[model samples]
Target: MSRERFVVHLPVLATDLAAAKRFFFCDRLLDGRRRCPLPADHVGECGPSRHR
Candidate 1:
């Protein structure tokens, strides 16, 4: 009976999937802490989508 906001980010490329961001809702979820690994060409120094 309550609402919670969650944010998820995923990197999408025309050639391939670059990265993925996840939100862990429950302990029973599969790959709850899984994160999309960044590709060699991808840059992590940039912040969120706002920066790019």
Candidate 2:
């Protein structure tokens, strides 16, 4: 059997989501590729958390 490879993108909390999004949008448009949308949960102020 053969296995396939995949990529995982961790979401960074967006303290400045609007600005971050504008930068990313322009980047993607200039690069000529569309990517997955950012989730709403990651927006706003970010703080450290314990993930288990």
Candidate 3:
């Protein structure tokens, strides 16, 4: 197998990333398919962005 480089733009902002992740990855968006972009043990009151 070989790797190729690609450049795809999402045209999004900081706030947009949060919204998209929530809407697409969160269980509330899909049919009970829960996902977290951040680590499971990393969640706190600060939020995802602050976790990183």
Ranking by lDDT: 2, 3, 1
User: What are the Cα lDDT values of the candidates?
Assistant: 0.36, 0.43, 0.40
What are the TM-scores, per candidate, against the unseen true structure? 0.22, 0.25, 0.20
Tell me how far the alpha carbon of residue 37 in candidate 1 is from the true structure, in angstroms, after superposition.
28
Reference-based TM-score, model 1: 0.22
Q: List the residue pairs that clash in candidate 3.
A: none
True lDDT of residue 27, candidate 2:
18
Q: Judging by TM-score, tell me the better candidate of 1 and 3.
A: 1
**Residue 40 miss distance in model 3 (angstroms):** 11
lDDT digits (tens) for residues 1-52 of candidate 1: 9668686666454433423222211222224454333333344432222222
> Would you give me the overall lDDT of model 3?
0.40
lDDT of 3 by residue, 9-51 (tens): 5564456755655433222222233333443344343223343
Model 1 residue 12 CA deviation in Å: 0.6
